[model samples]
Target: MNPVVEQMNRRRSVRNFSGKPVDEVHLGRILLAAQQAPTSINGQQISLVVTRNKETIARIAEIAGGQPQVAGAEVFVTVVIDYHRTREALKSVGAEQVIAQSAEGLMVGATDAGIMLNALQTAAESFGYGTTAIGGIRNDPQAMIELLGLPAETFPLVGTTIGVADDASLAQVKPRVPLATFAHMERYDAEAVRRGVAEYDRQLRLWWDEQGLTQMPSYSESTAQYYSRVYFPKVAESLESQGFEFRDD
Candidate 1:
């Protein structure tokens, strides 16, 4: 197998860190990789706030719903979908209409942030560091904005924790749904989606059992439960408070 492909295949979310500091040189390279990720129309609306401060990390861990890795990792990079810079740039060029209040602008900023974060993750992994993306950063977007002193037209998108993986962090690769499940040809196929998810649920249950885990639920059930019970209940209000408007016009 190609080395890159092998590396990707072996990638897993590492929640336990060995407490070793990431090298400064490696950190610089990882930041450069993140900057090299493509942006929409070269807008470059993504910004990263790198933190190694113990107290701040601890506070962030608390904000992240008590995820220890957020505080224990060697470094934490908070990815921000930032339109403040672009809006200023537009003003600099004498463009009066600079506010990014549209859905397209929000999506572009978020997509750019995601791309940069993925690049950062890949770079960290290439340097033999373990990383996990933390969506819990959005658990309290308002608090994050205040704590980080983020300006207007900016919002926390996600976070990445990087560190040397502890021995216990080396777990088996988690299974994903079959490619045909989401990768459509020309038209959407409902039957294929159902079949693929059913098969994937069975495979996931088996994988969970092999790992000495019980009480595994089907993918559809788990997904529905999570969205209906956990995520959706809070996300909309948070996003709206952060100045995101999901306008259909």
Candidate 2:
């Protein structure tokens, strides 16, 4: 395998850190790597707020359900999807057609944020640093926005934490679903994909068993029921309360 591909495969999210402060020069490089990530139509709507202050970090971690990973991070970076830029651009150019100022526009910002985050993760791993992405930052949107002092038309898309590795605990790679399960050729192949997923589930279960993780759960069964019970309603209510309007595409 190519070295870069190997590096990527070996990358894992680190929840524990050594609490070593990253110097401004290295932090600048990581930020620059993120800035260079690809964006939709060259319209980059991702905004990042870097927090090194103990108070802000504490507040963000509190809003993230008191995840120790967030508070323990040497640096906490909140990545937001910004819609105001698109609105300003549309008005500036006098475009008659405007994208809906809701989830549709928000998707663009989130996509940009995701791409940039992946780049930062890759760069950090290459530099021998440990990093973790915190999607839980979206759990309480209003609190996060208020704590970060975010402006209107902006939503917390995700967050990232960085610090020095303690002892390479996160050096191993997590298994992924088989390509046949998600990757398609010229057209969709549902049956083939289903079979691939079954194989993947078996592999995952075996891996879990070997790792002595608690009783292995069916991948599809848990995933299908997870949203209805845990994520969707909370996320929906939070977004609605924060004045985010979503329109059908």
Candidate 3:
């Protein structure tokens, strides 16, 4: 396998940061890599709000369930889905601007932001920095919006903490689903999921046993429970507050 590909394969989320500032040059290079990530139609509808302020990072950490990793990181980058820029561009050209109410707009904004985040993470890893994604930034979207001073049509979609890893940080890489079940060739295989679940459960059980832990719920069992109800009831309201509409038409 290629060296970079190999690094990606072995990469795992790390939550323990040493609170050391990333080198200025490395940080610039990492942002440059993220900027180079592909965007739909080259619209570049995403922007980053990066901070090295420990005080602000600490406050954000509290909002995100007090994750120490976030509070201690040297750099915290917020990936925002920014349609505000689009509106500005339209205004600049005296073109009529339209609000995004359909699913396609949401999909494009989210996918573009997510791809750029992957590039940022990969570049940071290449420079030996530990990285962990912070999805909990949306726990209270209104608070984040106010804290970051984000304007309408701009929302903090996700966050990433970057810094050196502590020696006592997480080291185990979680196992992924079997490739056959995860990826299909030519045509979809309906039975692959059934077989994959059984094999995955068995493997997970063995792993727990090796670690001297009791077996927990199987992957399907846990996922089914989690999806049984609407987990984030405020997400719709949050989106609306940020000028995103969900219209039935």
Question: Which candidate tops TM-score?
Answer: 1
Count clashing residue pairs per candidate. 0, 0, 0
For 73-177, candidate 2 gives per-residue lDDT tens digits of: 888888877665666887788874344345676577667888878888787777777889988877787788778777766778788888886674554455778
In order, the Cα lDDT scores of the candidates are 0.85, 0.76, 0.85
On residues 1-249, what C-alpha lDDT tens digit does candidate 3 reach at each position? 898998898788888877567999999999988899998988788999998889999989988878988988999999998889988988999985554565777888889989988988999999999899898888777888898899988888899989998868556666777999989998988899789988988887766666566656767777887688775566679999888875545
Mark the regions of model 2 whose C-alpha exceeds 4 Å error after superposition: 88-103, 215-218, 221-225, 230-234, 237-243
Candidate 1 structure lDDT: 0.85
Model 2 per-residue lDDT at 176: 74
Give candidate 3 regions above 4 Å deviation: 211-217
Give lDDT tens digits, candidate 1, residues 1-249.
998889999999998899988999999999988798999988888899999888888888998889997888989999998887887888898885334667787788788888988999999999999999999987877778888999877888899999999977577899998888789899999999889988998988988898887787767778887787666245566666766676545
Evaluate residue 191 in candidate 3 and report its C-alpha lDDT on the 0 to 100 scale. Answer: 97
Question: What 10-residue stretch in candidate 1 is worst by lDDT?
Answer: 229-238
Clashing pairs in 1: none
Candidate 2 colliding pairs: none
For lDDT, the strongest prediction is 1
Instruction: Please state the error at residue 16 of candidate 2 in Å.
Output: 1.3
What is the TM-score ranking, best to worst?
Answer: 1, 3, 2
